[model samples]
Target: MSPSLTCTSLSFAWPDGTAVFDGLDAAFGPGRTGLVGVNGSGKSTLLKLIAGELAPADGAVRVAGEIGYLPQNVTLDTALRVDEALGVAARRAALHAIEAGNAAEEHFETLGDDWDVEERALAALGELGLGHLGLDRSVGEVSGGESVLLRLAALLLVRPDVLLLDEPTNNLDLYARRRLYSAVAAWPGVLVVVSHDRELLDLVDQIADLRAGEITWYGGNYSAYEEAVAVEQEAAGRMVRVAEADFRKQKRELADAQVKLARRKRYGQKMWDSKREPKIVMGARKRAAQESAGKHRIMHEEKLAEARERLDEAVEAVRDDDEIRVDLPYTAVPPGRGVLTLRDLELAYGARVQGTLELHGPERVALVGRNGAGKSTLLRTIAGELTPVAGEAAAHVPLRFLPQRLDVLDGELTVAENVARFAPGAANNRIRARLARFLFRGARADQRAATLSGGERFRAALAALMLAEPAPQLLLLDEPTNNLDMASVRQLTTALESYEGALVVAGHDLPFLSSLGITRWLLMEGRELRETTPEALGKPV
Candidate 1:
């Protein structure tokens, strides 16, 4: 089958002269394709080009049919009604005019053959778990997750031939994500999604890996792609080992040849001193020896150069993914000390705590809830960023909160400077040393926070929070993995492993929460909290 989308010799560069793609070619056929890459690799830019939201500086983006795009961030005007947001307000108005016996040719034309447009719109909304939403309801009344579903519903209503979704699951809760997965599974036309959600990637027919302005296709889903990459990396590592051994052998041979030449030169000098033969014969012997030595030296040098080239090629084949190394023993909490306590707490949003509760030691707690369930409000209240309506939410030790928006970082400040603000007493050298563990080595720590990518910003924010002067005996994180790539997520997991503080993380990412070694699971539902098991939480509400 022919590809639904194709790019030929595509080239694009930002106004700042940073080139994103050059002489790049790619094709996406009629199937679901998951486009994945590390942060700053331009996955979203490629999607935009395909959707006509962006134009390439050179070459073209060819599409077989109509396109629908859902961007990473979906913003709706507060005044927009549900029907207006779905692009059916005019048709609905025309239908109402006809029903009231005031039909005009223009109204009929506006209605066209979509007499059931309203019903179809409602059905589409229902399919996306928005059945409870009224067509006349204001957009401001819906939650963030609902807005994402509403945008997707609009796209589905259009039924475009090629669908593009960039981080579609960014604000979606578990139930919303399941609805999206079903829609993706049922999609029959070309679908290309730029996302870091592993579960969403698992439903795709193939994986498109974008790196260094090039694309490489792998059959099957994310797991299969990972397996293939692992095998390839293993082979590359073996090749590197072989090349290094060959390089060492070549160097040893070169050194041995040099030593032999030096010994011969010394022996020739001794023979000349002893006057063992005629001067002409001795001189001829010396000249021949010098010529032979030159040849040997040139041959050995050539071999060594070739070996070095082989080693470089072999090394290039291996992938380089840096990991964060964090050590914060000072953040550890004593086993018997109370880290947090909640007594008859009533959140600002009216979510109530059933009874008194206490957390001690370095307990890791997972807070799971549906969207609009006040998870964020509860976390904010616990962090002292919000006030409870009726009761007390107290933290007995120094703590830090990493919210989903990552607003803890000051955009105008350098990464190291931001960390220093949080760690007032820490010396510059000490702050720089800790920042290095977060992968901001040397000059990288001096980069402005606004210039950092999503992943880099996350690391910088985490470093600031963890390396604070008070040592954060309790850490509260709200959906920390929302937009992070898989590599960044793994790095976060690694960094959290070294943290000895009490943790209460509110997130819908089950795999990530599980990896944090959570000892307790709390479910927020109907304005109350209940302790539960991971297995129980895995089930649908």
Candidate 2:
């Protein structure tokens, strides 16, 4: 296939001299490509480089046509009108002027051939589930998910031949996500998406596994990619087992050869000491024995070396899926232990709850809601970060809240230092030993928080939260998987599996929530917080 976008010998590094990519080459042909990797594997960075958001340190990116990029973090000026944010304000104004009987050449020039720009823009917005929004409405009026859709609608209006989206579904609710999915399914150009959203990846034409600064293409969607990788890992494991057996066999053979040589030497020494044969005959026999032993030793050693090399190569072929193995006994709550309570609460941004809400024991709750529906506000209220206007929102047990932005860590501090702050009075060695479980081993634990990638930062923040001194019995996580890759998401689920606390995670990731073994589902609407199931939400658990 001919590539619509290509990178040749691309290189990039942070200002701190941490190299992300070096002499990397990638090509995206005319199809939807799901770019996947572990956190900090440079998937997002590569998208930025290809989209011209970040300048490469070396080589170049070549595109066959116009490109559109939706960044992971979409920030729009709140004061701008929807049309302006969509890059259609000028064109729309010119069209309106011409329709109002203004025959000016400047208006015609500005309008160009897109006399139906207004209609097209609105159609794009409506297609993205923003039909209620008007071109004159301010961006601040829309929710985060709506804003993302608006940006995507703008990209669609321009009709770029190559589109790059980095975590495009991060802020989207189920309704908005479905809209985005439809758009992705309909996309005809070269679409490269760096996302942890499995549902989004399922729509892609192929999967690109980015690992250690290289791209390995898989010939289908996420599921196909997963199956392919499982097969590869199985083969790699078998090779490792075979190599290990050969290595052991070589060791045994070498040891046996040494033993035989030693016995022969001793026998010859004994014969020489006795002077059983004539002096010249004994001397020649000893010389021949020494040469024979040397050659035998060299042969065994060579065979052992080859075996070891095979073992090393086989081991290197296997993938590393390091997990967060943590045990927080203190965080565990016995059954029926009251953890949190909300009574007739009135939250910030004017969301009201009329009834009492209670959380007990180690209940895992999944909070699902639309963007701007006060999920974060509810979590903040439970965490005591927001003051409720009416009734109290209280947590009886010690609680910790991890927000979407992951602002728990101090940027200036190292990972170890940050964890130390969370776990005061804990020994330095203990903190590091625990940090290793979070996959920040040795020098990685010494890395500054500011220098870490999105995944590393999330892991560091999670370590601090889970390793806090009080060992929080109630954990509130808001969109915990926002910037995390699929692997990081799995690691998070593993970590949460060991967490014996009550969890109230506010996120749109249904698969991740299902993996957590949620015991309750809470849906947040304008003024109602009700118990609902995945079926009621029209999604699988």
Candidate 3:
């Protein structure tokens, strides 16, 4: 098979010369590959480099043929209809033959024997649950998630030899994600997927852990990589501990030798003062002392080399663990069993349809539906951001809403500033410490909120909520895992699980909600949040 994308000593750095990853080298072959890393550890940036969307500071990203890249942020221009934009890619390719003169055989080959690109595009769109949108439906009428799906459908119809996807499953629900993975897995091309979905990662042939400008290859899928990483980490720790122990022993031995040498010299001096320095062999005795010192020096040199070797391994074994710690401080318990009550709740904006919503008690409910579904609106109504047009929405305690879009955070202030702004009465030092707990310590704590990623923004907003004098008794989250990687998602999940405050979340990711052990599900459709399942919540295809 022809070689796919190749990166020879790929090096890239920011404008300030801060290295993202340097001396990086990897080749993506014709099989599925997963790129794993923490947030800001160069996963997405590397994807961009591979797709030729971002030029590296040094080194090259070479690809075999035409590449189709689907970015995490899916954008569709309003000028073009969904079908028009998608078909345009394949259409333009076919048009190339008509514009230029070529041999008949080659020309026929360039434009596939049977001209059915439109049909192919429509079929792909159907697979992605976008068939309902007609050939002339405007992209501006589409939801964000629908736009993302359209982009993928377009990419599939283009049939590029190289496929690069960054977080394709981010906003997709369980059914949608399954559909996407199935479609991608069937593609006959080089697939390089950068994602945090464990189920998705299991489909890849190899896993590349990008950290500190290096990619360590691990055969098999993410599960296998996890096993190997565990073993390697244990071995590294052992080597480091052994080196430290040996160094300590060597230091003790060196001290003992020095003391012995010093004592021997003093004894020799005493003998000389007593006029008994080897009796008639004084010159020989002095020579013997000099030889003994030379042996001691050689021993020290040997010990020095041993110490250097140990130090080298110790340094090399150092590894980094990127952990996100969110310490949520719960407010005093409300004098009520059920915190939020929604009964036949109906919400909508103007002509948008919202079905009836019914929720009750302190149960941790997962509000799930499609992108344009009334999930966010339901959360806003619960948080008093929007009043229901009909039906009742009531809560026993103060409810804090963390919107999926994260408009709750002020983009102008630093993380610390935002936290303090939200919880003004928290002790200054306590606020700073809280910021540090959320992985925004030092300059990160002082960073402008505008520069934060989707993950950091959520963390900052959560940190502020956690520090509230009386933490909102009920925490309402709307798609909390949108931009977070797998590890970060786990971190957030762990933090939320530990929270005593009740949680009412509206999320699209089944893997995440399932992982969190969410039992209750309120599926949304139109303007209604109804009890539903994976199959019944499907968007019209």
Candidate 4:
């Protein structure tokens, strides 16, 4: 009834606080507000702050109604059953019994005619395309997509007035994703979703660009935001160019005048002989004095001052353009045929087969698959991490593997030690420099491998991979963008695309993979690996 939520001058940070939001202000009434930003800009933190579970260092957030938050990673208390987790028939009686205190008592009374938790859960699950799931199944045993769907269903069951979702579609299949979008589109409550999925943004009415400790409102969807931002960026660029040009012109004039003065000074005494007469000396002095202090001279001084002001404004207005580094190197490999190839390879887990796998790599190939499809097991077989049940995985080229988790690095050793151990013969300085490029600079490079965030750890693993004399001919990546923010993902993508060798990576970020133009794909169904197109395997994350 009242405004759904209100936030004013809200600012927050940790004790050793990274000042995330500073004097932030916004309001959420009854519409979709899409939150967009590069990774680590504090989108998640802001959501938590608004939910009141997290306190802000400054300002306030007041909510008038109940809210539901769905984080990207849904931690299903693995011990809970599907029916238990879904609040199926088993939980409805309790939900209704608790409804004695609710404002929507009439609606509950109408619906409470039956303890139809299964039917209700089914209806919600159907909306997320997850109705087919067995009610008795364990939530722990469910697939990533299913768990995600269950969470969505749970959120809907409560029917909160405000929904805050982080990567809401992380566990959805294509159809499920579409359904989620449809639900969001039809919903009357306030919705705030933080996601990189462009398709999802289409349903949102506005975008809140969260960056540098503030939220900037942009009307309409992602496209409109892009267009408007483009114009703003162009304007900034124009200002910079104008300022630089004026500055350069003034500087050039100043240099020219100084040169002229120098030339006259050098020639004045000689050309106009003072010894010839007092008149000649007086003439030279008069010429020099007039040139030194006229309006033109004053104008040059004014121009210099104006130029500096323009330069400062230009610097202040420009925003950094997004750039990523793949750090591709041309480490020669034995020029040969396929190092690893999948020919009509099929993948399935216990006969619930998905798609086919069709891919080959001669260099450092990354074997990628979704959560259950056994990306890790595939990598293991190739690197002897696991034994493949059916398909023959042949590694024709010499290679090293970096798992999603850097199990290779011992926890006790510092990064330098890990580097030295694996990359034996490399100097400490070289290791430090390589680590620095990935943001592990200075003393930070000495941090134990256990201390790194998911992204930082991955970078360190990459650094370790490159430390060898002959870099691996193939690289295998699994959900490389999982923990890295969009910006870091962009950089990693850039480096991987330009990488001289071969690759196999499994990821939900289809837009990103397509941009890199992956050569092949191995679609994972249940346990089977079958040949497929890059287009078919991606989940449109």
Error of 4 at 356 (Å): 13
Q: After superposition, how far is residue 212 of candidate 1 from its true place, in Å?
A: 1.3
Look at candidate 3 and give me any clashing residue pairs: 21-213, 353-526, 353-527, 354-526, 354-527, 354-528, 355-527, 355-528
- Stretches of candidate 4 off by over 4 Å are 1-3, 87-117, 134-136, 171-179, 249-309, 326-336, 341-371, 389-391, 406-422, 426-457, 466-468, 534-541
Worst 10 residues of 3 by lDDT: 350-359
Q: What is the C-alpha lDDT profile of model 1 across 1-541, one tens digit per residue?
A: 4439889999999999999999899988899999998888999999888777888999998888888999999999989999999999999999999999986999999999999998999999999889999799999999999999999999999998899999999888878888898999999899999877888899999999898899999999998999999999999999999999999999999999999999999999999999999999999999999999999999999999999999999998887667888899999998899999999999987788878989999999999888988899999999888989988998999999999989999999999999999999999999999899999999999999999999999999999999998899999999998889888998899999999999999988777798899999999888798898988866654
Measured with C-alpha atoms, the lDDT of residue 366 in candidate 4 is: 30
Residue-wise C-alpha lDDT for candidate 2, range 350-428, written one tens digit per residue:
8877789899999999999888888999998888888998998978998999998898999999999999998899999
Is candidate 2 or 3 superior in lDDT? 2
User: Candidate 4 residues 1-541, lDDT tens each?
Assistant: 6548788998887788568878888887788989987766888888888776689887998887888888877888888877678665445555555556654555466446555665777788778777677666778777877787788888888788899988876645445666788888987889999887766777799999887877789989987888998899899899888899999999999878777766766666565564465876668786866676465667887889899998897887676534434353654444455666443332333322233333344333333354566665566566666644455566666567766556767778887777777667778887777666656679878898887765566666666775554566666665665556555666676656556666666565556666666555556555665556755544333
Check candidate 1 and list the clashing pairs. none
Model 1 reaches what TM-score against the true structure? 0.94
**What TM-score does candidate 3 reach?**
0.84
Of the pair 1 and 4, which is ahead by TM-score? 1
- Residue 492 CA error for candidate 2 (Å)? 0.4
Model 3 lDDT tens row, 1-541: 5549999988888888878877788888888889888778888898898887889878888888889999988877988876677865445455456557634565556566546766776788889888888667898887777787888988887789899899998777666776887887787888888887887888888998887778888999988998998899898888888888888787888888888888888887787788865566866786799798779967976896798698677768666555656545455443346676676566767212344333334456788766766678878888898987777778877678887778877889888888887778788798887777667778888888899876777778887776665677788998788788766786787767656666788876666777766657777665455576544544423
Please report the candidate that would top lDDT against the real structure: 1
For every candidate in turn, the CA RMSD to the true structure comes to 2.1, 2.5, 4.8, 6.0
Better of 1 and 3 by TM-score: 1
- Best by TM-score, which number? 1
